[model samples]
Target: MAKFALLIGVSEYQPGLNALPGAVQDIKAMQRVLQHSEMGDFADADMTVLENPPRHVMERAIENLFSNRQKDDLVLFYFSGHGIKDDSGKLYLSTSETSKYQSGELIQTTATAASLIHGMMERSRSRRQVIILDCCFSGAFAEGMKAKDDNTVDIKNQLGGEGRAVLTSSTATQYSFEQEGEDLSVYTRYIVEGIEKGAADTDNDGMISVDELHEYARKKVQEAAPAMKPEIYAVREGFKIKIAKAPVGDPQLEYRKEVEQCVRNGKVSVIGRRILKRRQSELGLSVEVAAQIENEVLEPYRQYQANLREYEEALAEALQHEGTLSQHTREELKRFQQLLQLRDEDIDLIEVPVAIEKDTIKQSEFLYQKSTETLIYKLRHQLVDITSTEIELAEQKEYKDEGLFERFTERAIEAIRLAQEETLRFGHNFIGTEQILLGLIREETGVAAQVLQLKGIKLADTRIEVEKIIGLGSGFVPPELPFTPNAKRVIELSLEEAKTLKHNYVSTGDLLLGCIRLEEGVAVRVLENLGVNLQNLREQVVHTINLSKNKNIQSQ
Candidate 1:
């Protein structure tokens, strides 16, 4: 029996539809796997790919895919694009020319209807047919079909054939999602990964059946995005149709599956580690080999978590400056999302709640504004006088041309060194505000440590809170860790505080002031969680600085 396939990818759409840049890439990926000699074994001339085809071109292609095929021939049709359903619930696969009215009504004539594809499928002589759809509302193509014994739609009844299979990226009512930072849609990515890695050959029979491929892709898609539920439909012997060949008795594949089971929330569980150790011995693989495989398996999860943390930190810093995000901040955030390869949906999950929390705090503060205005006014006047005296003293001292490093006191420098150590301890590659706070507390002789201790924020408790907030990193710390933007801002603010306090060198007290000044940083969050009163803490640090200044003046 010969194999023939047609793949359609629609990326450019009319004004009414959003562009899907990944759709074309999806077609390329599928083509690669389907033409692999050891896998799909389909001849190059037997496979066809159409990218961003117009409605008529797409319709003709679909007709040709199922036309003139023998009963024993294997026919496959794949589409990745927008899937729209009309009010009557008929699904249409969109094309480059697909458009909708301003009222949000679909222009049916502008797209290829599923009914046409079904008609083509019914007229095909080939019994071995596979239809794979990676698009929104894709499952709706099986509408009006009978349910099989397994409760899945009967493709034979809908698309019409004794031996047929259909796989959709999402349920009838759900939308198929494109993963951010990925070259293919979430469903298609797993599908390609399964075929390329031979992980779909679950039974180790060296063959990847259509049903097995769908099952493997479904589990992986759900793991990455639980809201998505990929569906598969088959009838008669369709479920047993072998789509590709897998490497049998592959030790790496065996180990990879075990590692998948061990991974949870992006990290290997303690029990999972023990299980992996035992599996390694049984598989007769060396420790280094197993570790390499496990790392490969875990990389995706770790990358996702890292993206989330980076976005969260950037959002937190932005929220500190204003209750409502300015246009500039919004643009900055968008850049962050793109740079971090995060999806809009994923970012919404982190941003919405944080914004609501900030709004709630603003509302509560407004309620007390009237009562605190007079006290705030008095404090401001007092601070002005203190600032004037400090500035006069600061000017009296001779200035030196030196870098920021030369301006730091020995204790301040030690605290920074401790910050890098803390970063390594947390397995993180960057020093963030939380690490800086830990460093300050660890430098026991620094004034920042003294103030923190007096406020009941112990080093041990702070460490716990820091871990709870940011968690451990991916365990690949670089030789030289960089400082996060917030961390760098803290150092800049500390230098300003030192200059304002008439200290030629940046002291630990100045660093503490800088941390307090950064209202939105992880450091401030930890301090608040530890029950430290920030305003009072700031006043105490200033008061202590004044007392030290007076003692020095008297001794001189």
Candidate 2:
């Protein structure tokens, strides 16, 4: 089962484009990874790397790579280049000469890297196609082309059968960064090293599988930079990968110094790194141990470091408070001495200031009753500020469930239950969210969701036109509806509406009104969970509802 790779990385553009040291670095590093990593051995077949290639050359490179592939064969296509989108978010592959970055029109009328990939996939007889695109705006490259018009068709959905798998360097709107000591893009560096580390190398042989490479690339990228996520969208299960298992150690923080020393001293390495790669095969170590040793390249004691920082911070805060209190005491003691001097002639017992020895001691026993009054006043002001924030948070948390509107919790709980079902029925441990959404979508008839569903609003329609509404890493909130004090208030507002002239048990359409009324409630929160803006869902729902009403009237 030999696998072939079509690797394309472009760094130098025909001047005036964003300088992409990333593309060249990505290709060279991946090549070494493919050679030394287990995937390179397992898929140890023909691989081509087109460095700084022109557009036409890149396309040719792909076509040539697939020239020998078969339906059962695995094909991996890697691209590292600059990408941009049109106004419609249609992604375009930068030819060594794509001038002027167009914001809105970027995606509408552009030729994309994904389109190129789709062409390769359609032409190839390969059963599983794994594509890794490590470039700025890489997610845009896959937006229009990877999935087959159906959101469920592409690599991310893991629905591949005869199609390819797609892995992107960054989601839409963001750029990938560099790793320390690695010339490759941070993402590419880890991906290649991950493969070399045998995290992707499944067979214990020195070869990494295509799937393993993808997972390794994704997990490593995510850990290194949580903000810029590397995604793996698979259309099919191509390879049985042996993920680089972490070495077994003390579950608690019992042997951390020993662990750090071992890592620093070369007894360990993280799962995906190039530094100690040469020693991996020679170690004859378990995959877990090997992976852990490789991960050490990053030094995974941040939690302990965080704890240490927190301790230092607490000490500083305590000292600051101590300084402020001491200053207050010094002033109070001075006032007490002045009062005692005033009372010296009368020698009054009640007004006598308590005499103390040293500067520290004199301040320590200064008048407490007056200080208590000032402390109480400060405490009240602090309490007021804290109280307001807690009240606001309480309001927000009340709708955390969106009053059953967003049942992320319920869905999560149900997901666990269904996971049990899956294990009981099929005996697999990986119960994914996609499956949960699929199952829930089929079973749901809630009043709020029904408005969209009734008019043929497919949840999967995001495939065709969602990225335009929500750019990468964006969030949205819906518009306002009438304030409803209670559930009955929602019903009352619906009844007051012109459309629901005659109603009985409240059709799902009426629930739309209810959702809109409670727009400030769970409805908006649920939309946020799906990454759907309230405005987008509102317009879509209105359009669908109107369309349905028109059809019904026509029939009548």
Over 4 Å off in model 1, which ranges?
Answer: 138-162, 179-181, 278-289, 303-556
The backbone clash count of each candidate, in order, is 0, 36
Model 2, residue 360: distance off in Å is: 24
Candidate 2's TM-score reads 0.44
| lDDT (Cα, tens digit) per residue for candidate 1, span 24-89 | 999999999999998888899999999999999999988988899999999999999887767766
Over 1-556, each residue of candidate 2 has an lDDT whose tens digit, in order, gives 5667767766665433445655677777777656544235434457777776666676677777766677777667777666554444345555454445433233222234455556656777776667676654533212111110101112332223445566666655444544324466766776766655444443334444556666656655544444355665654454443222322222211122233334532335454234334444444455676555534544323322332334334333533456433665545433332221111111111111111011123232332223434533443343332223433454677722122221112222232233233222322222222222222333233323333443344556522232233223222212211112443344344444324434222323344454455654433344455555556445544443343333232100
Error of 2 at 493 (Å): 39
Whole-model lDDT, candidate 1?
0.74
Best by lDDT: 1
How many Å off is the CA of 11 in candidate 1?
1.6
Task: Give the poorly placed runs of model 2, Cα more than 4 Å off.
Answer: 37-39, 42-45, 101-113, 136-163, 179-182, 201-211, 239-297, 300-374, 377-556
